[model samples]
Each structure stands twice: as structure tokens, then as C-alpha cells.
Target: MSTTLSKSYYHATSSVSLSAVTTRDLLDSVAKKTPEKEAYIFPVEKVRLTFEELQRQVCTLGTGLLSIGLKRGDTLGIISSCAPEYIMVQLAAAYIGVVLARFHVGLPNSLLKSALLKSECVALVVGANNDDVYNQLELILPDLKTSHAETLQTDEKSKLQRIITNVEASQGRWKSIYDIMNLCKKDSENGKQRLEETSKMVEFGDPYTIFYTSGSTGPLKGTLHSHMAIQNIYMMCADRYEWTNDDILLSACSSLSHATSEMSHIAPLILGMTSVILSPGAKIHDNVSVIQNEHCTVLFSTYPGLYNLLHHGKINEYDCSSLRYVMTSASTIPTDVIQKVSSIFQAKVLHTYGSSEALFVSGRDITADEKEIIDKVGRPFGHTEVKIVNEYGKIVPINTQGELLIRSNFLFRYYIHDEDKTKQVMSVDGWYTSGDLAKIDRNGYIKIAGRSQDVIMKGGKTMYYASLVESLLSHPNVKAAYIVPVPDEELQEDFCACVSLIGDTSISSDDLKDFYKANIGIPAYIPKYVMVFDDFPEMLTGKMDQKMLTLEVFTRLGLNKEWLVHGRKA
Candidate 1:
């Protein structure tokens, strides 16, 4: 089919049927259908939970939460790694209709406090192994140092209880998961009744979970999603990938805090597939060993994680023939890396496009021709509608880059406690402005250019750093490339290319600049300053930290605010 240019709007041709079932109900149904099936495996912790065992733990913990005065609409904050306890708390929170607020383990104390306070979480769950959590909790709750501070009283009398897992000690007001379970076991009859009633009350439209953005560029915002929206989005993902009950999925990119965790961990439980949760701080060899030992068939991680696995020299020592697909996203995938993944794993590489607001948007399978895999992000998701619009909000022609707008049933409900931020991105008509510059091809595939904020202006032309970086990555010696804007006298902004080369490649900055000028064929697009780095700063979510890199570049180059205001000569 030829591409059509009708306001640059395109809707997905395929759609999957969805059910009006809550996440709790879905899990129960799966447990009932396959009671003996393996649901979760934590190799690092040596923990395994079958479908029936998982449901039992969820029900017990959910009852314990309700016993501690947590009710529907109350929020439970989880700051932990990818462990069995984390999954238990998450499922229990969802089962009891409590809003699960996931806090990344890497978040600073200031952001962590802001997230918990803003979300008004009634309870906090932390893993004992996470030293940051212990350190931050002392600052957040000063009373903890005095004695066992069971609860923090708010104006509304919504007391916040602290629960810590994997430790036998319940010092200071912190309660252990074992203690909570014991409390529920002591009143098993009452807990069971309360759990059953609470589960029955939950509906598909109820708020399920809140995930905060990485906040690498701005303040963290908690994005909320309803049970129906998240569940169906994952269902669609499973359908798109044709995931089967026998498939074992491994998540190496993030823990429970990230959106990808839900796709790799939670969704697989409902589908009766095995989910292997790797512990944090796992190395490249650990990942490969998990896949080999677990006989994992599906792998979901960020581009860096996949890239590491592809180059981990010892990967060939493992029996990875069971792997069927390696799904990665969150940043640009180098063309060579994509090819290497396929060649090494003999599996399809899916380059997906998604965000905290919109769960799963579009994905391209790298098993296709090299050019198509490198150039496009696949078609619109089964139930998503995407469009490209210019500054005037008018539809742009096909293949013309503009800000992307998406309308999807799976879009987040709103930013918790931030109506102004919610209104900034969401329109009354249901369209969510992505703030990403992208273009749609005639054949309906979408290609992301770069964030609108990242566009560098040179002279009178707009230059997208992503395109330039992609070209630089195509060079054999270049391992990774990042483009940042620098103040210029003649041009509005000059380009600064920060690159890391393959081990001891002997490729210099001048050599890369010459290669770019020869290949890109744009004199202005060639970056004026080329900086070489052994490594780039990365955010918790595994994406390169562009904001930090830019700041560092300015500081190192002795560029000041005066230079930005009145060109570099100032």
C-alpha cells in the first residue's frame, strides 16, 4: 500500500479485544486455570512461586494491608529492587485496590520524599537490602531514630506505616513483612473475609498503580494508570508478540519501578508464563546465565543491557537457543547492535517505542531488512492512533518531521496531584502530545527524529541531533554518540558531539568530524566541537543523561550564561 498524506494521521489496522476485568480478577482466573504453573522465579534469591502460591501470598498480604487500616484509594509506596517481596506487595496492593506508588531505588532523598508526600501514600514498603532506602527513611521520618515509629500522622489522620522486608529485626517503628504476615495469620478468618470482600469490590476502571518518570530532564511526575488501561495494554503487547504460556520472560533492564517491569513481570503472570526477576547490580554474565539456566524464551531490557549481552564474549558459552525474541527500547538502537543481537541470539529484536504516560505505542521487529529496522519504529500499536503536527497544530505531510501526537486507550489517567502538568500534556479531546519530533512514512511506519526541546538551531535551519548521532553510530569505530548544543556567534546554536569509540580503536575526534562531513553532506550539520568520553552518564532508566552531559560540557568548556545570552564571544 502506498502512503497517504491526510493530516499525517494514522490509526493501527489491528486491534485486540479487551475484557472489563480488574488485575486481581485476571490473576485469579489465571491461577484457577493453571494452578500448578510456575508464575515467578527469582534466581538470585532462590525463590519460586507457582500460580496458586502467588495468589495465596497476594491474598494474605492484601489482607494484612487492610488490617493495618489501608483501604481502597489509599496509596502504598514501594521502594525496592526486583525481588519476590516486591512482587508480593505490588500484587497485594492491586488486589486490595490500593494505589501502588513505585519509587525507583536510585531516586535521591529529596525526590523520594516529594513522591511519597505528593502521592499521600498511607504505607511505605522498602527492601532491607536497599541501603539507600534505609538512609533516606531516616531523613524522611525523623521519629524513626527515637523509637519504633509505627505511623506518621497527617492532618487527615491518614497514618503512614513502614514495612521492611528480608530482615528479622523490627527496630525503630519499622515492621517486617513476616510480622505483617503473622498479624494476618493470627486473624486468618477475618483477614480472609476482608480480602475476599475487597477483591470483589475492585473494578476494571479503578486506579491501579503510579509510576514516576526518571526526571532526568525535569522534576519527577507520578503517572497514574487504571486497572483496565494497563492490563489491556500488556495484553495487546502479549498478542503482538504472540507470547505463549511456555515462554519464560526475563527482565534485565529495570526493577518494579519502571514501566517495562510491568510488561516483563506482571503481564507474564496473567498469561501463565514464567517471569524471572533478576536482582539489581546483576552483571552481563548473570543475565546470560539466567537465560541459559531458566531456558528463557523472551528477553526485555534497555538498549544498553541488550548491547552488553550481545558483546559479553562469554555469551557463546551458554545455551541460548531457547531465546525467541529480545525486546529493547528507551533509546536509539545502533544499526550494528541490532544486527549483532539477531546474529548472536538467532532471535527477533523488537525496537519498541513507549513512555510512562503511554505504555506501549509502536514497535518494529529487527528481523526485517536492515534499512527498515534501522529507519522505522514499526506501525502504530493495535489500538493507538498517531499523528504528526507542526507548530500551528496542523497535520504535516507524510515524511515531514513534526511533533508527534498520540491517542490511545491505554494512556495514563493523569499526573497524580498535579492538575496543571496533566493539562499540559493531555487535551480535552483525548490526544496526548508526545513532545517528540517524528515523521510518518507513506507505508504507516513512524520514525522518531528527536525531542523538540533537543532540536539544535544552526543559522536558519533546524537540525535534529538524533539523525546526526545515528550517522555517527554507523561508523565502525564509534561505540556511542551524543549531540549537545553549544552557543555560537553566527549560528543560533552550534553542535557538540560526545562520542565513545570501540576499545582502543584509535579513532580521534578529528577523524569522526571528517567522517561526518563526508557522509552527512551538510556543512552546518557537522559538529564544531567533538569530545571523546570513555563513558556517558546514564539515568536510572538506562537512557543517556543528556541534560547532565550538556551541563558538564558547558562547565568543562568554561561557557557561561553570558555566552549563551550573547553568543560564544561574550
Candidate 2:
């Protein structure tokens, strides 16, 4: 690895070169260069496809899409897990310049309705499972008994024209993906000719797909990433992380719909690395077995994923010596989880920090005593620039806390169809305000304090939940802690600290407060109310469900009435 350690703003430079290329170009190069090389290893499905086969499969699907009136730049949304069908649609959409959009597998009816109208996806593809990915979606589609193609009608007027799915429904309106694949066999010459012509229309700047935010706080917003932007991320990561053909990456804690999995699915094939993907909702034991059986060398996971794996997973009984780096991101990783993963897996714990706006902005591989400073997200990646700006829109000194801003070639182009939201975060000169409070120390290590929204803005004083949560995490009996804002008639907002204990250990709210008073040391870092939770709910991305947890706290405390500034009843 390159020695990126430095002072002065933590901007790491790279000697590697970059280019503007579409995803199709990279796949073509790899397929021609190493046709027989393994591109994917889906151990759960007992499926392995070579580079040449992957190329053919994507191309076939690309032409098939065009045969059904789908044109370049038409949005095709996918609702699936880490299945082969999802990969085919993802790459095929990129091959023909059709914009891809994704929805969570567990999307609710209300959110699905809201997203369908605004997402502008002309077609939607679902997984083989009729109940999981397509349950809520099927409610809006024509009934299963509908016989004619004219019966295809959505509840509202939408761009939706076709509903392609892996499952073959009895109705003709629902187009089967297998039928789309068979289009190549019927008109092989015409399909291939049109595929070539359509491929030429693709450009580096065209929108590749839209990724929805976790929506833990509110409704999901569609973020658009360009073909060139994703390619930049792939090239930069291959160079920065020093990934080789020998590296085997194992996907954990996320589905293909997540941003973290977007490039992981395509870039590994282009970079000549073997990617092993397990099914979504796979148990911890099965995940550990895949690493042992596949001889996996690397893993990308979130905090809860690591914790669940180490705590509940039978690591000592299995052979996990092949692990090289346990890369983590998506949320603040607890130091305990990092130490356990590093110690058990004998791997370097690499901390990463990014958002929907930009992915892979900064990461640090923990070694030696660096585990003690696990809060730092290392330095900025190459070809990326980061700055801290105050509320007045002025740049701040190093080690000062302010909103984080970043400029990179790999950032998402803009929020799709929401120009006001785009202008709110992205500046005219290209610096995207992250809305995250952070700092760069003298040694050039970046530390995330908290999100700007995490602060309690009331009583003319801003109190950050990060400090109090950090204190709560420092408690030996605490496992996870979250400070959620509660409505107040006078202060406008008061907070309640909800904590989950380690294992079966228990502590009263009074005892927890006493421990914080004696050991916390920082008087400003205190909580107004405290409640205990058996465990916090987690989103699909393996991050804590802050929105749902906040609601639970409110419901438990009876938030309808005026609550005091201190000592809230639980």
C-alpha cells in the first residue's frame, strides 16, 4: 500500500492515472483479456460465471430490453436481493444506457407508492420470490387473475409501462425475465445488430442509476450517479487499496441495492478480483461458513454485522485465516467491534466514511496502537478534496469542527428531479456540503463528530448528541447508545438517551447516570433522560434504525404532553 500518512489538510495524492469510461467498456476489456476468469461466485446459489459468459449474458439482456420498447435513458428499477437476475439487469441497463433505480426489498406500501410516482422508472424488475421483493409492489399491479395485456394498470398515472419479473405470473402483462433472455434466440442477428447500435449511444456522463438513501429519518430521495463517476470510483479503489487479481471479496450485511454493493458487483469483475456474494437475510453461521469454504481474503461490513458475527458466529470452530482486511463503514463503528474483528479474524480493520453524495471519500487501515484512535476515518482518498466550513460559509482551521465539504470525481451528479434539494447541498463551485461535523487533527487524521442534524437546537445553546453517546458507549455495561430528540413545549426539543446493554447485563437508568456523572468528566456531555432497550432495530444496511428508535422512545414516554427539561418519565 502507498504511504498516505501526511500533515496539512490530509489530502493524499496518487501517482495512478484515471480515465472516463463506461461500465460496459471495462466489462468488455476484462472479458476479452481473461475470458475464462471467474467473475462471480454466488456460493449460496451454487452458481459461478466466467467473464466471457457474464459479458454475453449482459449483452443478451441489453438487446432484450430494447426489443420491448425500452430505449436508452429509460429508467428500469430493480427490487431484488444479491441474486443473478439482479446482476444481469444492473449490467444490462449500464450496457444500453438505461438508467437503473433500486427499491428496498422490504419497502412499505406508502413508500412504494411515493417512490413509483417520483422515481420515473418506466419499468420495474423484481426477484423470483413473490412474497419478499414483490409483496408490496404486487398490490399496485394488476391482479394475478388479469388475463390481457390491456389490464396492466397502476393505481396512479406513472411512467410505468412494463413489470418484468423472474417469476412467471399467469397474467400476460407481467413480462418474465426468462422470456426477455429468450429474445436473443428468436432474432439473434437483429438483436445483436441493434445491441451494437444501442451500445454506441452510451456515454461516460450518462446517468447509470439512482440509489435511495436509507430513509431512516424520512422518505427516500433518489441520488443519481453517472457512468464516469462510478468508473472513477472503481479505478481509484483498485489503485488506492492495492487490490489484485488474487483478492477475493466477500459481501456481508448489504444487498445489491445498497450503494456499497453497486460498484462491488461490477468493479471486481473489471479489476480481476473474485467476488463471493451470499444471499440476503443469510444467518451469521452461513456467512462465516462462506468465508471458510470459499477461502475469502477480504470482507466489507458495517458495525452491527461485525458484532453479530464475532459474538454469535462460530469463529473459533472455523478457519478464517484467509481474511486480509475487514473494511467497515455506513455508520460510526464501535471500538469494541473493531478490536474483536481484528483479533479474531487476524485482519486489518479498515475504517471508511462516505455518504450517498460521495462514496469512498476516506478510509484508514488500523494497525498497532491505531485501534485506540478508532474514531478517525483516516485521510481523504486520492483524486478527492475535503474541506471544513463554518455556518458562515468560511473555511475553518485544521482540528476545528464544522460542516464537512468534499469535491471528487466519484460523487453522484445530483438528486434526480429535485433541483432544490440538489442546490441545498451542492455548491456552485463543486464542493458538496456533507452536513456532517468533522475535523482534521494535526497529524491529518479525520474524525467525524456527528451530523449537523444530530445536535439539539434549543434554549439558545446547541448540544451535540455525539459527546453524550460517546460517554454512554464508554460505559462498560453499554452495548449501543442513541440520543433522540423529544418534542418539548418550552425548549422546543429535549433529548432522551436510549441505551442497549451488553449481553444479558442490566443497569438502571439511575445507575447509568451516576456512572456518567463520575467517569464522564465532561459536564456539558450529559443526557436529560435515559431509557433502556433490549436491542436497537437495524436497517437493511446494518445501520441503527434511528427514526424507528426515536418513535419508540416517544411512544414509551407519552410525548403528547409537555415534558420537563430533565428527568423524563419512562
Candidate 3:
């Protein structure tokens, strides 16, 4: 045998194949075939766009961005809800390989400033859908109110040079998004050349999006994902879920700032599935009518919203039988809830397990027998490698609780601009350390046994226990505070600020509200409900008995029935 390996040996080394495609490539290919097919439907705005229309919008915006000097690899931040304009900016930026840093329209000053600085965005795009964007941005960029339409020159330290807006405000403050779109069209000479050059420079390996999530024991982490990463996940998910071009997908909950946005927005856009986007300010009840009217094939989020809708029999008023399946990964659903939801919709309940690190890990399809899906997160995808490892980094045996390690090409490239955080979570060999506690059985099904991180999934947003607790403890009137998850009918979970005040400081609920109004405006932290505790319960091991304390809190809040029906703190 020769020292060098043969062609067969080289091929056998790896079973996975890389996808050589970008979001732009997929959209272009789909639009070419389905030129007149409906690609997006914005019910609230009464807007419907075909494949060609949407493609033209994306290209126009991409060219306008190029005209404004935001080229390939430049960071472009967006602050808006999941409106039609927001989608346009997202796709347009991706079209020319501009990295997008999606900011939640509801984000407070504290979080937004940090994210903006860390992302180092060259330009920020503001959407007209939400009014909060103005108030929030004005706090960070003091010059936002005074800067002319040309470029932003602020006292804040970052790469920010321009502020673009789709909304009408004071004239010289920002550049109109509409004006920018028409800027290149206004100059046809340079526009064509820049568009061709920019499109050609776009590569499959370019970083497409930065999805920020709450850190386990630290600050917010922005997960950088490549075009290849996003494309692979969409391709794999569509194949696995048996999605077809005829499927009409709607993101019933959350927005593009979420990790699931890739599947909801980009997947449907590129894969020929009709994307039904709701305008900003749509209430929880809007989904019911949308599903009834559009005959949406799939509902893309949630736990409590659907549960409450069905539990109260409100869904009976609508003909939503067109739904083929409801996909959710916001949090684990109890077995009883899964069965109830499936029956209510007459569709399969697909419970997924995913995170910012590893886009899609595993999922459970509700079966007739409870044993099949009970406490199980199903098997890993074909491209994924999973193992339950102990504290010592050794692989544990089947059915043993340990940290779940995920290895896949679909995993995020890294934590954006943070090498230390990236190295902390990922191993040199490419294993991602997921803090979740899980177990693998002989049948190859994985069961989640809780997790190490004190994370609360409120509605569809991720809130860290440490961040809120620290904010609470920092108050002059507070001594100790513990943030606990409370169940609700609307929001999947709510936060209860259980606090033990410092001596002689008599701060009532109103005082807490006032404090939150001044210091913490994030709804996830300063919730509507607050509870004052004498002290938190402790275990024999001298540590806080979080489980017992949570139960006590629930009982006191008169929410005992919430946990009994769910069976456990999932």
C-alpha cells in the first residue's frame, strides 16, 4: 500500500457534504422558477408580494445599500418588529453579503447600547412599524436627534456612521429608507455596476446574521452564523419535516430577532413556501383569524398562547383545520399539553429542542402512546452528533443525566467579536458545551432533565436569571433577590421577583415598580407581578432550595393548578 491514501480513503473520512449556496442564491433560483407565485403575505398591512416583486425589492435595497457605501462584510444593524420593511432590510442586506445585527425593537437602552457597540455596525436601519425604536435609539445615540440625513457623528464610541429610517420624523435627523432605495435608481449609471460587482463578491461562507441570546452566567452573546450554516439548517429542516412548496408558513409568535427566525423568514422565502407575516402591534388573537383566513399550513412558535387559545375553546370559533402541524421549541411542553394541542388543531405536535449555539438539535413528534414522546426530545438529526457527557468531560452511559454536547456543521460559527466567549463554550475539536442536562436511552431518544443555567423563557424571549437578579440586588433597598419563572396563559412563562428587603427599608410593590421604571424597562425583568419574601428556603446542603422555593411561590401566588396540570417544571 502507498503511504498516501487513495481517493476512496479520502472520501470515506467524512460522510457530511457542505452546501455551496447562500440565501441570495436560493432566493434567485426560487424566484426564477416561481416568478408569479406569492412569496409573502402581510395580512395586517394588506400587502401581498410575488416572487419577482420580492426579489426586485431585495435587489433594489441591496443596490441602495451599496450606493450608500455599506459593502460586503459591513455590519448593518436593524431595530424593528417583524414588519414587511424589516423583512426587506434583512433580505436586502443578505443579498449583498452585508452582515445583519438584528436588534429587538423592544430592547431597552442597557442591552441595545452594549449590542450596538459590540456589533460595530456601520449603519442602523429604523423601521416605521414600532415607535419604541426612536425612544430607545435616542438614549444611546444622543446625536440621533440632531444629526443630519447624511451620516451620524455621535459621542458614542462605535463604527456607527449613519442612521437610516423608514419612518417620517424631523427632516435632517436621518436618511429616509425609501429615498435610499430610489437613490441607485435615481443614478442608473453607477447602480448597475455596483450591483453586479457586489452580487459577484457574495460567497457562501459569508456571515449572514448575528442572533443574540442571553448568556448562561454572563452578558449577552451574539452568535455569528454563516450563509452555509443557515442554508443547511433550512434544507435539513424542510426535508425532515416534509415541507413542500405549497406549504404556507406563519410565525405565530416572536420575531426575526429570535433564533427561530431563520426557519420562519429565510426558509420560507428561499424554499418557495408562502411567508405570511403579521404587522407590528398584532395581538395574540390575530393568529387565530390569520390561520382561518390564509389557511396557513404550519404555526411556527409557542407553548402557552396555543395552549390558552385551545384550553379556553376560543379556537372553536375559527376554521383552522388547514394547519398541518404546529412547530415549537420555545420550551418543553408537558405530555398532557402536547396531546391536548394536537387534538385541538388536528395536527401533529412537533416539540423541538434548539438553541443559538446549535440551531436545531432534536425534536419530538407527539404520538398516541405517551411513552413515545414523554420526557423525550427525540433523536438527533443525521448531520448532528450528540453525547451526554459528565463534569469531567467523559461520555456517560445511557440514561445517565449529564451535559449534552452537540457537534454539527449547522452550529454557529462563533460568538461575534468575542474570542474568549467562543473558546469558553466550544472545544478545540468542535464540540459545543450545551449547559442543558439530558440523558440518552437505549432506544436512542434523548430526554431533557432540566438544565444548569437559570434561564427563563418568557413568551418566546430568553431572559437570564443572573442578569435580573443582579439588577435587583444592586438596588439600595434590596438585599437578596431570586428570579423565578411563573406560568401564565398568554406568556409561556412569567418572572416573579422574590425579594428579601434590607433592614428598615419598607419598599412596597409600587416602589419596586417605580424603581423598574427608572432603572429597568425590559418587561422580562420588571414584570407586572412582584412578591416580597422574608427569606428563600434552603436545603440541608446549605444551598438555596430553588425547587421548593418555586413551589412555595406558586402556591402563594394561587397558581398551584398551573404546575399540577403540567406535571413538572418544564
1-570 per-residue lDDT for model 2 (tens digits): 333333224455677766778878888988998889888888778999889999998998998999988899899988877477888898899999999998877777777767777778788887776445555666665443353562245556677867787554433456677788787889999999999999888998999988888876455778899988777776766665677888888877566677877656866655878888777757888767888898888887767778778778888888889988888775476777788788889988878788777977887734424743577887677788887778898777777888888988888888877899889888899988887888876655688888887787545467777766778898888888898877656766667889988778978998988887788775556666789888787775556788778778878878753342353432
In candidate 3, what are the lDDT values of residues 263-283, reduced to their tens digit? 777766557889887654566
Every model's TM-score: 0.94, 0.92, 0.77
Model 1 ranges off by over 4 Å: 1-7, 13-15, 153-159, 163-172, 365-370, 514-520, 561-570
**Order of the predicted models by lDDT, top scorer first:** 1, 2, 3
In model 2, the runs with Cα more than 4 Å from the true position are: 1-12, 141-147, 168-173, 365-373, 457-461, 487-494, 561-570
Candidate whose lDDT is highest: 1
Worst 10 residues of 3 by lDDT: 5-14
TM-score of 1: 0.94
Q: Identify the runs in model 3 with alpha carbons over 4 angstroms from their true place.
A: 1-17, 168-172, 215-217, 311-313, 365-370, 453-570
* Residue 521 miss distance in model 3 (angstroms): 41
